[model samples]
Target chain A: MLLPYLLLGAILFVLGLIGFVTRRNLIIMFLCTEMMFQGIILNLVAFGRYPLKGAPTFDGQVFALFLIAVAAAEAALALALVVLLYRYQGTLDANAYRMLKDE
Target chain B: MPPHPISLSALLPELILLVAGCAVLLLGVATTAHRRRLAPWVTLLALVTAVVVVLFEVLITGRATRPPAAGSGLFYGSLATFVRIAALELGVLLVLVNWSAGREEERGEFLALLLFALTGLLLVAPADNLWLLFLAVELVSIPTYVLVVLSRSNAAALEAGTKYFYLGALSAAVFAYGLSFLYGVSGTASLAATTRAVVLALRDPNSLQGGLAMVGIVLSLGGLLFKIAAVPLHFYVADVYQGASSPVAGLLGFVPKLAGLIAIFKIIALTGFWDTENRAVYWLLWLLAVASMTVGNVLALRQTNIKRLLAYSGVAHAGYMLVGVLAGPLAGKALATDGVSILGNGPAAVLFYIVIYGLANLGAFAVLGLLRTRGGPCETLRDVAGLLRREPGLALLLALAMFTLMGLPPTPGFWGKFALFGSALTASRLTGDTWLIVLVIIAVLNSALAAAYYLRVIAAVLLYENDQPAYAAPREAQSIGALLCGFLILIFTFYPSGLMRAGQHATRELSEPRATAARTESPVASAVDPPFASP
Candidate 1:
């Protein structure tokens, strides 16, 4: 019974990883990371609700809460960086900022 | 259950950093005109105070035979004290370096962000729970992303911040995903409890629980490899280091990297993952060490840009540190015998190497910051040419730092590399493992390869002639900090025993309890089940 929920969470995680790697737009890439966070949150909540044995514990749920908080902080920073990049380069494309590379 | 009174003294250094950081932020707004002059002093005062507090903590711990009363909750052990003190001392140096090098406009924000990051680093050492560990890691990372952009408003700075943020975020997610799996299998977030659970699960290699725990370890560590700038995750380093201002780049080089190493060490200690029967983990770290050294050094050899060169060198250093990690007891079958432990030596070597590397790297970057042209900070090998003629003192300081990085004798870098490679050799001897001897050989060759590039920079400073006039002299504050770092490097080189003693103390404090815990737990597990003998 717990297997399906775990499998679903794993699928979401892999999907998020794929999206993050394949997507070129900076904002989209960040959103994909968020998607990955969501998947982790799902797994945490699922595990909290159903233990492998005995009664359910709140450890996983508490962890998921902290994860959400940290993820929010990360998102805020990511957006600010994105805005800074756009203001400087006038594009959200990752390839647009290559001034640091070696010739 | 009766509520436990929280020990505020345990959190003294971090609390000081937090209050000072917030105060600096407020001061930035209230006294804008005076901030450029006032902020750095305040930051320095806060850092000094925190350092004093850490020293006091260390002293008290040293005198006491019993475990510290304050060691129970968030803060635990002398390792925490040592790591915190080391990190805060580096923070003070960074503040001094950044004081004059950072633009006047962002002085307040710069100091404040740096303190916030230090607070995160300070929290990382003593974090008992995975939740706190994750939070501390983020706290360290987020402010750095902002600081990367705050150093300059140039396109490169912004791009560096963006690239750093994206990769950092991805790594954090990967870490979180791994943690969730760990939580699912272990059913707890406390590292001690989770370790027990993970060991039990791993006793059955074919079980679903065992498979999940292995996945969790890989995924979590895989994410952390970004901070260390190991291969496959080091692609962003050169660009980021080059984009950020030199002082910020120096902070980038050490702060997060040190925090990550300590955090990883804590995880390994708590999870006892190194001592597990899992040879896969050992092989994985071995592969990473070899790859990072080869890739970092070889790529570094061709780099014209000094920042890129240092960035790759930083990668290579991380590889060297990984060799120390690989030498740890986790990789082998040897456990405690006659209570004379070899387990802590690997971590001790790493700690010692970090202090040496931090001093040298920060000094080098400080010199780079000092040698700025009207165009901007010196970025290429050619820029440093004729430095010997224009500024002999700065040229010599840079040369000392370069030689230290190359691990030449009479410099602290030589001692650091010796200890690291020596520990690996010891571990190999203990385990009768030939792979570690091979690792030591690879590391030695890589250091030689690294010398080729480090020498090139040194040669440029001393040999090449430039008729162009000297750029503006470095600011007094930065020159002083650089000199102090150079002096410390020289002093530590001649008197290396003190640093080695402290490193051994920190490592012993970290591993002793775990050793005892394993000893007590193993007997019970072994008596009940013949197949599940604890290593």
Candidate 2:
């Protein structure tokens, strides 16, 4: 019963990882991380419904709530950094900000 | 257990830091003019108070002296006490380093963020559950992202901040996903409960439950490796270090790495993975240790920018510490030979190494922060030419720091590396693992290779001559701090016993839970009861 949900969560996580690696836009990369969080949240909820023991408990769901809070806080910081980067560099492209790299 | 009643007194240091952070932020809003003058002092006061509290808890009053409630779940163990004290001491040093840097207007915010980060670090060392661990990791990292960007308003700082943020966010996501899987399999978030559940699941290695848990371990560890600045996740380090100011870079270099390493140690101990059928995790760590050392040193040899060079060197140091991690105690007693057990020394060696590394690395950055030109900080090797002739005191300090980093004798780094590599050799001999022996050989060779670059920096300061105008004289406070760090490094070499004793004490405390968990892992009890359930 839980197999399909677990599989879906795994797929979403992989997709998010791929998107994060392939995307160059600062905001897009952050969104991909959010996608990854959502996938994990899905798994947490599913696991809460089908716990290993006799009765399903809310521990996994509670953990998912905490994850959401942390992700939201991270998003706020990410957007602020992105805005600051754009203000300084005049672009959101990750490739444009390569001044610190070795020549 | 009904979720043991939380004890505020056991959490005094973190509570004090949190209040201080808020007070500094509020003071900034209330008294704008005096905010700069008041902030660092307030932060210092908070750090001193926290240190005193930790000292009382660990040394004066003692762990057993605390109330019963104070010794459970979130607040237990001398390991937490030791790590918290270390983090507080490092926080105190970082605040001192940043005392004169940054604009006056942002000083309060800077101190506040630093305090918040220290609070997070202190919380992390004592976190008993996966949820607290996740929160503490984010709390430590998010402020650092702000600190990096706020170090300067330039495009470079912004770029570094963006890169750090994106990668950091991704790593957090990966960690959360991995945690979900673990929670799914174990049906609990408490370390003890999860450890119990995973042990039973892994008894049957080919089961679906065991497979999922293995994935959980790898993914979560991958997330943590980013924080430790290991290979494949270390690409951002050089750029970030170069972009951030020297003081902030110094904090970033050590604090997160310390927290992450301790967290990893705790998880590994709890899971008892070393005793399980899953030997693949051991090899994965072995590969990372070797790769980080080789890659960090090889690339560092070509770097001209001093900051970038030290960044790579920091990465290499992480590799060395990972060797200590690899040498951690395995579960079974099969490897024990002749009653000489070397298995448990890894954590202690790592603890000792972090203190030495923190002093040397932070001291080096302090000197770099001191030698700023009109444009900005003097970063390249050429920029420091003839420094010995111009500023003998600063030059001597930098040279000492460089030599210590190279693990030369009569410095703490020598003893630090000696203990770490010794532990690795001991583990290899005890386990009769040929691979660990090879890893130790690579580590020794990497240490020798690393000396070349560190020596080149020393030579630039001592031997080369440049007609460039004399560098600006450093502020007295900053110079004194760096000098103090240098003095400690030199002094500790002759008297390493004190530090080693502390390390042993902390490591013993940290390993107790695992030892107990292993003894109590009866299949019937674990299968019948959900250990984490509230009564």
Candidate 3:
């Protein structure tokens, strides 16, 4: 019964990882990371709801809440950085920011 | 479990820094003059105060010998005290390196962010709570992302910040995901509690669930690899370091790397360690140590940019430190036949080495920040070439850093490497683990290979003479920081027994608790039905 939540969370996580790796746009890549965070949140909450053996506890739920707060903070910072990067390079393409690397 | 994992007094120093970080922001609001004079002072005052408090706790109060209220998320021991003191002391140097960097108008935020990052780094040692550890790692990271951009106004800094943020976010997601699996398998977020769970998983390695349980560890470690700039995830180091201003690059060299390694050890050391039965865990680290050393050295050889070279050097150094970690802490005095006890002290060696590496790295970067070439700041090999003619003092200081990094016999860096390789060799002999011996040979050979690149820096400064080495307006504060690192390394080289003894003492209790726990070999069996009973 709990297998579906685990599989769903796992699928979302892999999808997000794939998106993060393949996408070139900065905003979309960050969104992909957020997608990854959601997968974690889902997994934690589901595991909390139906634990492996013991009675359900709030540990995973509490962690998920903190995860939400941290994700929000990351989003706020990510948006600010995106705006700043957008100004200088005038593009959101990850390829545009290649000036720092080696030839 | 009823007793709070974190006590008020336990976190008093970090609390002080946090309040001071916020106060710096408020002081920024007061007036420009107030901030210019007061921000750094406030930051330094808090750091100094934290150092004093930790020393007081360890020396007078005997926090070191106190048995950890086991199952408490924080370990109250000499290790926490020492890591706190190191982070705080290094923090003061960080302030010195960053004293006049970036825009004066935004200096308040810069200093405040440094405090926040250090506070996060400070918390990593005692934070055995999975949630707290994750956030602490993120806290160190998020501030650093902003700090990179703040350190310089150039497009390159922006690009570095952009790459660092994206990759950092991805790493965090990967880490959290790894942790979520761990929490699922263990059914708890407390690291101490997860120890029994991890032990059970290790005992049943043939089961499929055993593989799943171990994935949590390997995946989280993979995520942490980014922070330490180890292979597979170390792609960002050179770009970020090269793009950041020199002082900030120096800051990058030490803080996150130390925190990541400590957090990884905190997990391993707390979990009764990746013991002999776990060949996969051993080999994984073995592979990382081999790969990081080889890759970091090879890529660094051809780098013309000074900062990029240091970045690769940082990667290679991280590889060296991994040798100590893979060796694990010396289990007991029973392992001793003589003074060779030093060989088994992996945790202590890493703790000692990273700080020494930080000092030398800071001195190198401080000297680099002091001088600039015609095109820009000291960016290339030729920029520092012939520095002996223009400035003998700075050139000599730079050469000292190079030699130490090269692990020349007479330096503190040599002692650090000696401790690491010795630990691996001792571990191999004790466990009959020939792989540790193989690791030692690889590390030794890599150390020799590393010398070629480090020597290039020494040769550049002392040998070739650039006719027009552009000098930045004298950055006296930064020069003092460089000189301070050099003097400290010199003093330690002459008198390392004190530092070595301290490293050994700090990890003494760190190994003892886990050692007894592992000896019991009945963690899961002792517990009542329902497996993990959340009291």
Candidate 4:
């Protein structure tokens, strides 16, 4: 059962990494990255169920909680920037925003 | 469990900082919204008090009959002191430098974030548990992400902030997932225990999970390397630096990088990667370090924008610092005792290198911040032409910064690279590892390569004619900043004995006793100006 869940997460993560690298839509790339993070969190909580029996077992769960919090904060800030990007350039395509291109 | 760890007495300064952060938050809410300059002032006061308290603790502890061990307290020992002092110093500097940046409304949030970030850096080195490490990393990062967006006026600020957050979060997630795998194998987050478990797990052929876990740990470190703007993960740095406002860029460049470096050091120390027979981790660091050094330096050569150039330059230096991590405990021995073993002096050299790098880098940025134009700010290298004619003193400071970056003599950057290169050469000789020698060669060559661009800025400022329109000149405050940073650069070079002594002392206490005693009695340890060992 654990193996199957782990395999599923690996699939999702790879998919997210691929989309993030391949997709040119700035918003979609962000979504894919978020998906990658989510997959990691899923893997963590699943493995955390059987933490060291008597040694404060909630470490993984606590870590997961923190991850979610950071994810929320990141999303809030990223979305705000997205709004600003569209306002500045009138588009959200990664290819279109070449102001900071490698020189 | 386990006697509730240890007494929280060792955590006095951190506790004070925590209180200060809360007080600043409350004050921000209570006071008039526009008059938020008070927040930074309050944060500054709190940091001062915290620094004082830490000094008191250090004095008290040092005098004690039995000093606390490495793993004592919630977090105790000299390594804790080194980490805390570096973080706190940078934190104070960030607040001082960024004091006038952004609008009045944003200052409060900005200071609050900086204070919170410092708190995170303070927690990282002493973090015995994996949970603490993760928490500390996040605490440092979250506020920094907010700081990237604080400059409301710049379109680049908003874009940079967004990209930074997205990538930073993605990396943090990667770190967490890998951490979970390690926890599963060890059934504990204590770094020592985790290392033991990793060793046991790695030995078994059937433990594919354990092998995967090792990969996860390495992968997670990629996120941290990103924060430090090290190679491969260095993609975000130039853009972020270019996009963010000057003060914000300065903060991003220094404070977070320190935090990330400390985290990297702590994790490596806990894992005892130095003792392990597997050369895999060392090889990985070597490859990354070389890439970071070569790529960052080569790329920086063509940059027209000063900040973008510095950004790449900073990445290359991070690679050099990682060399110390690869060199490990004997470098500590070299610090605690020098030249006893050819293979081990790299760590002490690295520690000293970081101090010099931090001071020089911050001083450089502070000067750059002062050079604003009517077009808003002068980030491009062309803007600096003929600056020496108009402002000779300021131009000199820029030259000093460039010289330091190039690791030329008398500057801290040179001494920094010299110490590490010395150790790298010796280690390579003893171990017969040609790769280590190659790294040293690359490092030296890169320093020479860096001189081209670094000198170009100076040459343009001093020799080239100014064609760009000169608008309203920098005010009194800007010049003051320039003068202060310039003085610091000069002072670090001129009176190197005290700081070098302090750095040597700090490195001495960082490792085990056998290494310390062996190192303490060496000639190189005592000799201040010995050139690297003969080929």
| Evaluation by TM-score, superior candidate among 2 and 3 | 3
Provide per-model DockQ scores.
0.51, 0.55, 0.54, 0.34
State the weakest 10-residue window (summed lDDT) of model 3 chain B. B519-528
Q: Rank the candidates by lDDT, best first.
A: 3, 1, 2, 4
Off by over 4 Å in 3: B4-6, B65-72, B274-276, B331-333, B336-340, B515-535
Off by over 4 Å in 1: B1-5, B60-73, B329-344, B469-472, B513-535
TM-score, candidate 2, is 0.93
Candidate 3: which docking quality band? Answer: medium
Each model's lDDT: 0.79, 0.79, 0.81, 0.69
Error of 1 at B44 (Å): 0.6
Q: By the lDDT metric, which is better: model 1 or model 4?
A: 1
Query: How high is the DockQ of candidate 3?
Result: 0.54
State iRMS for model 2.
5.1
> What docking grade does candidate 2 earn?
medium
Q: List pairs with backbone clashes in candidate 2.
A: none
Regions more than 4 Å wrong, model 2: B64-73, B274-278, B330-344, B515-535
Question: Model 4, residue B189: what's the lDDT?
Answer: 58
Badly placed stretches (over 4 Å) of model 4 are: A25-27, A50-56, B5-9, B25-34, B60-74, B203-206, B331-343, B467-481, B504-510, B513-535
Q: Residue-wise lDDT of candidate 4 within B361-477, one digit each (tens)?
A: 766676667676555677777777777776677777778878887888988777678767877776666567788888888888888888888888878877888866223245554
lDDT of 3 by residue, B186-233 (tens): 777766667667777767777645766787778888889999999989
Ten consecutive residues with minimal summed lDDT in candidate 2 chain B?
B519-528
